[model samples]
Target chain A: MRMDRLRELREAKGLSREGLARVAGVSAKTIEAHEYGRTSDVSVSIAYRIAAALELPLDDLFSASLKAVTLKEAV
Target chain B: MRMDRLRELREAKGLSREGLARVAGVSAKTIEAHEYGRTSDVSVSIAYRIAAALELPLDDLFSASLKAVTLKEAV
Candidate 1:
């Protein structure tokens, strides 16, 4: 879901994960994790940086409909 | 800072911390932490839920300029 969209966005911008990471001032691993949806949650700050690098609004990269399991739900 | 904005938004909407949590389906502690900037990172998923409950865009609650300490910086 997120992984596919992130990959599409990155590719659309002609950026590799490493390239996006550089522009976003984050580690390539972080970009990779986001692309793969490896992390359980994405920090708001990270999303902001990636959106800035991609030159898009944060909501575009992550849609409002994306559901997440809250800690209340987990417990 | 992120905390101030979130706190202001919630208050302006006539929502207490616990009330916002109930609306957002997250723990009250989670809302409190975010209001206080206690957490180092905010999950994008959580942000989406809160934004929905607040009836605002995610970026409004958390500005794009709210910088975070990236993992690379932490290491």
Candidate 2:
């Protein structure tokens, strides 16, 4: 999936791809590719690692806005 | 950021990490790591790749739930 937030967050944290890769037990190439939008396919486990690295909740990384709805009382 | 949705979506599409990697121009290892929660740091460009490969909107891939708020009518 897309990761614009991931990149922004990483940069804000001053973490290099290599450094993040080392911490996450992934390869620099992998990190590089992901950083470059080279892949969408990923596993739940990996998502967890990334979330842990970013110190963000898993839901925060993959959820979106909800549709708005209004309700009215019935007579 | 986490990618639990990515994993679920990819699997639903019946694509392997290698297959997605090829399409996204990323290495299989990268996909694997991302799937296994091995990395949190990523670039915006890479996020685009993953989104493209998955055929999902960029916003869908990284956006999360919003905080709920209720307002009261003023007198």
Candidate 3:
């Protein structure tokens, strides 16, 4: 759920937080919080908006660091 | 951003929506909406919770259908 990539993608697209929020139909604060990792407990719908706005695959938004330990071992 | 797998995983773990929500620190309605695909724009934090509660990798929750077209060509 890391959003570093999302923010980077948004910036690369030349979109401001407010601009992206409008396109996603969410509040600026919501987008800001998401970018800062404040609202980790977000709905799937918001995730879609982010992916759409960033022009990324929904999977990309959820993609974890390959360097991290796998879930199979974590559990 | 499909949540079918989330629901399936929750069920496999024998957790009710309420139970999962409680564990994830969100309302049951949130879980319900997420499970039903009502919220496609969720935050990364919530995504992390869902993954942790389901004992899955964050990517597992976001993994898309490989059969679908990729985002690289979408834009």
Candidate 4:
């Protein structure tokens, strides 16, 4: 349910809450809810799409390890 | 939305569908729905809980690679 790393990563990428939501095909409120820990009910597809939008592996969303686990490497 | 890897991994662990659901803290129907692609709206916490039940990294749920990413290493 915690997503501090996601907020930091999104900020590091210079993406706005709205920007990430748009590209990830989620509502801006969805981004806000996850980032602020307002909800723990995120969908798997949305989480995966956000990771894909950030060009990082899905683990990147939940982990702080800088090691890049690309989708290719993951699959 | 595809989670064939989850079904394969579950079976490889020699766990019954109901067993995994109980261990993963999900409904048996949730396991069936996901394994059979009958639904695409899996919750993030449920997904993570299932991965924890399997003792596998979250990425393993969505990917075919056999590399084991442990929770310690993931953190």
lDDT of each: 0.71, 0.55, 0.63, 0.69
Q: Give candidate 3 regions above 4 Å deviation.
A: A1-75, B66-74
Locate the minimum summed-lDDT window of 10 residues in model 1 chain A: A66-75
For residues B1-75, could you state the per-residue lDDT of candidate 3 as single tens digits? 445477878888999998888777667887888678886545556666667777776556654662122222222
User: Would you list the clashing residue pairs of candidate 1?
Assistant: none
The DockQ-derived docking category for candidate 1 is acceptable
* Tens digits of per-residue lDDT for model 4, B26-75: 78888888788887556666777777778887767875332222111222
TM-score of each: 0.79, 0.42, 0.50, 0.73
True contacts kept of each: 0.41, 0.00, 0.37, 0.44
Candidate 3 lDDT at A55 equals 66
- DockQ order, best first, reads 1, 3, 4, 2
Stretches of candidate 2 exceeding 4 Å from the true structure: A1-75, B63-75
lDDT of 1 by residue, A1-29 (tens): 14336778899999999899888878899
Fnat value of model 2: 0.00
Better-scoring candidate (lDDT), 3 or 4: 4
- Weakest ten-residue segment in model 4 chain B by summed lDDT: B66-75
Model 4 CA deviation exceeding 4 Å by range: A63-75, B63-75
